[model samples]
Target: MDEIIQEDKKVFLYLNNLGDPSFDQLWMLISSTWIWVPLYIIFLYFLYKNYQLRSLVFILIFLALGATVSDQLANVFKYGVARLRPCHDPSLEHYMRIVKCGGQYGFYSAHASNTFFLASYLGILLKKKIKWFPYAIFVWAIVVSYSRIYLGVHFPIDVLVGAFAGSLLGVIFSVLAQKVINKQKITP
Candidate 1:
């Protein structure tokens, strides 16, 4: 286990050293919540305007719940694992410009997790009207995950695990939320 981890770290370092400043700048710009938040709100507004009120309510609730759960889970992993961010890790070779060394652990990226959860939740909700929703979600997920790497904060595996974990959490929460709503309808 230790050997495998060490090898993975070596790979992460190698990849981190290949960063391009231009890509890093682009990643930083796109990953900003200032841009994505308005976009998210616009999407929700469109859904509310075009879809049934009940559906809009349910989807918005589920999306909020999914985001909260995903964020907490990522935080738990970060504190529990207590791994150092690549920018802070002396063992890793750094080449990219460091915006800031985030929390102590880089085992899983919070940005990746949160964006992935949002993407998955929205994709599921909008699956019917937009055939391309899933693809767009995937593109966003990849970009958000890669931004951590480009910023010299997270390792590739960290981003990958975060994406997987967040997606799973989003799906689970959506199903759970739907079930709860169904039960409430049946009872009252």
Candidate 2:
């Protein structure tokens, strides 16, 4: 465990150090949830385009629930693991570039979890309707997840675990939502 943690720190440092001051603001913006509102709106538009009003409402409910689950699950892991964010780690202070700092714990990033959750959820929901969308949204999730490392707020392992958990939650929720849709005979 200790050796793996040490490797995590080393990898974190390598990724965090790749940042340049010139791109700090861009990464910080990318890290901000508010900055992605337009993209989220676009996602909503796509959802509306694909599903009927009733089905869309149900899908939206599942989306909200999945995102909440992903975020809360991350919180549980963060507090349970009690791992320190790179920005808040004393040993990493000297070696890392702190473009932005978040809370004390960042074992698994909520941002990564939530974004990946949305990506996986929407990607599944919209895959058939928009053939190219799944790939694009996954890329978006990856970039958003990477922004946490670039900003020195999370380790690579943190983001990786969050992405995995979020993806799993997404698949679960999407399956459940699809069942509801199928049972209701809600045609898109």
Candidate 3:
């Protein structure tokens, strides 16, 4: 465990040091949730175009529930694991760039969790409808996850764990959504 942690720190430092001041603003903007509102609206447009009214409502509900679950679950892990974020770590404080600092604990990042959850859930739900969607959304999720690292707020392990957990939740919720839609006989 100690060796793994050391490796995680090494990786985090390598990635975090790659940032330049010129790109900091771009990454900060990308890291902001509100900056993605237009993207979310575009996602809604895709959902609206693909699914019927009743099915779309159920899908949206599942998305909300899945996002909530992903975020809260990450919070649970953050506090429960008690892992210090890179910016908040005393040892790394001087070594790291600290472009943006978040809370003390960052065992797993909620931002990564939420974004990956959306990517996984919507990718599965809309794969057949829009062939390129899954690829595009997964790429988006990767970029978002990387932003957390670039900002020095999360280690690679934190983002990786969050992505894994979020993807699991996405699959679970997508299955449930499909079942409910089928039971209600709502065609998409």
Candidate 4:
């Protein structure tokens, strides 16, 4: 376990140090949640398109619940694992380009988990109607996840596990939401 973790750190340092100063602002923007507001608003359009007002409320509620679950789970892992954020890592401090340090623990990233949760939820919900939706969501998720590393806030493994866990949650919740849709006979 120690050896593997060391290797992971090596890989993380390599990736985290790749960003040039010129692109720091770009990565910073990508790592910020506020920058994604327009994209989220676009999601509102889809929800309105797919369901009547009542069902849209239910779907949005479930989506928010899924995101909440993803965030809480990530927080649990962070505290349980007690891993330091790359920016806060003494060993890694000299080796990486840290634009900004986040919280004390960063075993898994809530940002990655939350974003990927939305990606997975929206992907599954819109796949039937939008053939390219899933791919786009995953791409967006990846970019956002990588931005965490670029900002030196998380290791690659942190984001990877977050993505996987969130993806699983998304699948579970989306399936449940789908069952409800079917029962309600709500067609997109």
The candidate that wins on lDDT is 3
Tens digits of lDDT, candidate 3, 124-161: 99999999999999999999999999999999999999
State the lDDT at 114 in candidate 2.
Answer: 94
At residue 19, candidate 4 shows an lDDT of 91
RMSD of candidate 1 to the truth, in angstroms, is 2.9
Error of 2 at 187 (Å): 1.2
What C-alpha lDDT do the candidate models reach, one value each? Answer: 0.75, 0.93, 0.95, 0.89
Residue 165 of model 4: what lDDT?
88
Model 2 off-target regions past 4 Å? none
Query: Candidate 2 residues 1-188, lDDT tens each?
Result: 99999999999899889889999999989889898999999999999888999999899999989988999999999999999999999998999999888889998989899988988899999999999999999999999999999999899999999999999999999999999998999887
- Pitting candidate 1 against candidate 2, the one with the higher lDDT is 2
Candidate 4 lDDT over residue span 70-109, tens digit each: 9999999999999999888898877899898899999898
TM-score of each prediction = 0.86, 0.98, 0.98, 0.96
| CA lDDT for candidate 4 | 0.89
Candidate 4 to truth, TM: 0.96
Candidate RMSDs in Å, in order, are 2.9, 0.8, 0.7, 1.2
Candidate 1 residue-wise lDDT, 67-113, digit = tens: 88888888899889988888887766454457546776887888889
